[model samples]
Target: MSDDDLSEKVGYGHPPKKNRFPKGTSGNPKGRPKASKNVANAVELELDSKVTVIENGRKLKLSRGEVIAKTLVTKAMKGDLRAFDAVTKLLPKRFREPLAEANKSEPLDPYEAEVLERYISRRIAKEDSHD
Candidate 1:
């Protein structure tokens, strides 16, 4: 019966009183096997913004942030904290080139192949829900 914003009457507004995520704050929240997905700006990021710096025939196009996040999580899951820390430090800088090259030449790494395949299969299932 009023034109005013519904939340505004309660003293909140269009924007949340407090954002769940601080700007640029990264990491997963509780109670999930998967971490955050579908981040913005990252999808719109152009290839030219960061070129694949391949070397020794290994390559990847993913951002350093993405690589570090995946690597750290995998390592942590395997209970290899030292490896996790090492990968966190290394992948963003040192492995960026090799990963870029490796990605270009190979299907997926042994570790990632299955994960990607399963994700694709699930996505396809959802998309073909009518069938």
Candidate 2:
């Protein structure tokens, strides 16, 4: 054999070109199986699912998200403070009532006003004490 042929090693790192995989085909012809639907896709599919609900003694079809929102509003109407907070947070900013404007329109009861005043005074006193 010539010196060039002798110098060309064909072991672990170097395989004969004919033995290598063709450009288009893979060693694994099937290839890795497509990945399953991810968590966000699954959640979106779930939210878009439809369910029947009774409203005003009539059957109604609503999306899962709509049912959840309706339930949240019902709970809030029944004086569930946490549900009310959640409903407010979920509302779009354009639709949400501003707290300052709401407070200005609906004056607090005497007891509530007095309690708020005392709370503010105590907070100020505590800050003064800290200083």
Q: In candidate 2, which residue pairs get closer than 3 Å at backbone N, Cα or C atoms, i.e. clash?
A: none
**Best candidate, TM-score-wise?**
2
lDDT of 2 at 14: 93
Candidate with maximal lDDT = 2
In candidate 1, how many Å is residue 109 off? Answer: 16
RMSD (CA, Å), candidate 2 to true, equals: 10.0
TM-score of 2: 0.52
Ten-residue region with minimum lDDT total, candidate 1:
8-17
Model 1 agreement with the true structure over 25-131: per-residue lDDT tens digits: 66564546764555465564542255464645888676655655566778877977687667656656666777667668746687799898898899789869967
Please write out the lDDT profile of model 2 over residues 71-100, one tens digit for every residue. 999999998878999998998887675763
In order, candidate lDDTs are 0.64, 0.88
Between which residue pairs do clashes occur in model 1?
58-101, 58-102, 59-99, 59-100, 59-101, 59-102, 59-103, 60-99, 60-100
